[model samples]
Target: MAYTLGIDIGTYETKGVLVDTAGTVHAQASRGHQMLVPQPGWAEHRPEEDWWGDFVFVCRALLQDSGVDPAEIKAVACSAIGPCMLPVNASGAPLMNGVLYGVDGRAEAEVQELTNRIGEDTIISRCGNALTSQSVGPKILWLKRNCPELYAETSHILTSTSFLVQRLTGEVVIDHYTAANFSPLYDVKTQSWVDDLADDILPLDKLPRLLWSDEIAGHVTPTAAKAAGLAPGTPVTAGTIDAAAEALSVGVDQPGDMMMMYGSTIFIILRAQSQVSDPRIWYAPWLFEGEHASMAGLATSGTLTHWFRDHIARDLDPAQAFPTLANEAAASPPGANGLLMLPYFSGERTPIHDIHAKGMLFGLNLTHTRGDMYRALIEGIAHGTRHVTDTFAELGQSPKRLLAVGGGTKNALWLQATSDITGIDQIVCEKTVGASYGDAFLAALAIGAVRRQDISMWNPTDRTITANPTADYDTAHALFLRLYEQTKDIARDIG
Candidate 1:
């Protein structure tokens, strides 16, 4: 039986899956890694150890556990947290740690500098995106200015998925969806790199060849095959960033389909009918040519709850801490008992692209308990999601179907709170194994084993979280909007 292998390198862990054409997951594996913070407002990962290391370990574990022969695995694909910036040396060796996604605010000054030089309106007109922490062009300038010696040595720059693909196949190529995030350096209308914009930032020839996510990039090299425990000539697809693959896994095919990814960050992706120009949200050419995508993300979500667990819930057992905290949060009444939080621990994105923004806990009283604070944190994230959804609707492109996925989908209280705050029903899938599973399906498509629509059959809808609005949350959400505006400057000062 022909099989496909998929792997995803995520914020906190790497996950892999081995599956056949029939949608049966033969085996799965995961490995944990740390996100490094060398300074304030910066996050990095050691690519060699964290990315390729996890990939190697997971592949061996999956093959051993499943008892599957390597020759039977027909195709391979990978996805990772991206559109990150990683300058590499002549031989594709990383010159520095990979700068993570919008979570790292190290390029705030570069964002402002580019916007001032190019004008925000002109940027939107050219790239269909406003200069924000999410853009890679600014980050490249940051590297050039801050680390001149390293930048001078850089032969090429790559995102996480691009790095992995190059390591596997010796083919330096990036997917259209991920390449579009290099705003100011990519042309949304032309669907190719913009030398006029990129030459000003860095070398144009350093950029990777672009391909659709399902297109075969190249076959695995003999050296890579030995390291990754795969056959010598297995075909590898041009994998995308993790979120796009996750959205694909859940059958977000049509224009109105959406994916709400509740991981360390709350990411939202909506399939678009056509190219959209929105300053409040980022737009990109979709995984395939001619397709379009609109994306929004909060800098923090599950990360906030994680902070509370490690710092506040210190008394609970480590293994049971999350569930225990969830139960406590559930016991608290809605509206967090008059407490409200701004989930801006890492700063804000999407609707409010403020890098200097800081978290706020408003109306905290002496009577409040740990549970109330936890509930407020989750509610704040939901409010941010609502803001993004509202932006889409105001632009006349609200998603008709919302699919929920990721680790946080298992948290009933958190998922329900998001539904109550947003007033949009969310559908959970039967197998929401996320991006790795999506990668496997993409591998199947690349090798002609399955059609594009077969994903709906592989992962069926489990249930829906219908909207159940409450007056308490309505009042809190109203305050949520007002609180941000009122304290914008104060948050900046604090940050």
Candidate 2:
């Protein structure tokens, strides 16, 4: 049977899947890696070790476990945590570690400088996005200004998926969906790169060639094939950011469909009928031509839970900690026993875009327990999700259907709380394999083996979490907003 290969590099782990065109998973594999924080406000990943190394390891494992011949794999596709900033030399070797997404706030100064110089109105009009930490343009400017020597050696500025595709096919290319994040560098109207907004950032020649997400970038090279254990001539598609693939995997096809990704961060992607020009959210050309998507994300979500488990719940076994904490949180009353948390451990994104925001645990008293704090943390994340949804509603683009996916969906309390707080029902698919599973589907689509609507057959709805509003949560959400506003000045001072 003809099969396809899909791999995804995430913040904490990499996952891969081997699947037939019929959507049967033959084999799956995963590997873990770290997000290095060399200093405050910076996040980096060793491209060779974390990105390409994980790809090679996962590919070999999938092949061995499935016993599938390399030549039988018709197409290969990949997705990664993106809108990342990485500088590579002419040979496609990474000049330095890959700078991560919105979580890394090192380019705050550059974002402001460019926004001021280019004018926010002009930026929003031309780019369809505001200069934030998530934008690759400011990050590139940061490299040029802060690391002049290294920037001088840079030949191409690529995102995580672009870097991976280049390594596989020896063709430096980026998808329009991911390239949209390079505000002031990417023109949304033309759907191409331009240097008119900020010529000082980098020459357009240094950027990768842009293509649609499903377009064939190139064939795998013999060298890459040997290392990745794939056929040398297998076709590779122009991959996109992980979240986009995840949305497709869960059948987010129509304009009103939104995918709520509960991964390292709470990333949301809404399929839009037209371009959304809100500074609060983000706009990108969809995977296909003439389509659009609006995105919003929290700075931290699942990562905050990990932090609490490691630091506060040390008494519990590492594997059992999350479950135990969940049980305890369930025992606590709604509103988390009057506790409220600000999930700005890294910083805030989307609506606020406050880099100096700080994580706060308010209403803490001696009466509080670890369970209450954990519950509060989850509720805080829910409040953030509600904030994003409200913004979409204000823009008259609220999601008609919310599809939830990722590791956090398994957490009953987290899932239920998000639904309750957001007042929106969430649908979970049968295959929550996330971006990698989406990658497999994209691979099939690229080779004309499957259609976009075929995703429903591949992974149907498992269940839905219906919204259940509560007075306690309603009051808490109000305080959640007020707490941030009242204390933001102090948070900035402390930061």
Best by lDDT: 2
lDDT of 2: 0.94
Candidate 1 backbone clash number: 0
- Expressed as tens digits, the lDDT of each residue in 13-69 for candidate 2 is 999999999999999999999999999999999999999999999999999999999
Compute the lDDT of residue 341 as modeled in candidate 1: 91
Candidate 2 residue spans exceeding 4 A from truth: 469-472
Candidate 1 C-alpha lDDT tens digits along 1-495: 999999999999999999999889999999999999999889999999999999999999999999999999999999999889999998999999999998888998989988898889888988889988889999999999999999999988999999999999999999989988898988888887886754668877888998999899999899999998999889999999999999999998889999999999999999999888888998988887778999999999989988988999999998999898888888999888899898888888889998878898899889999999998988999999998998999999889999999999999988998888888899999997999999999999998999989998999999999888543466778889999999999888865
Question: C-alpha displacement of 344 in model 2, angstroms?
Answer: 0.8
TM, every model: 0.98, 0.99
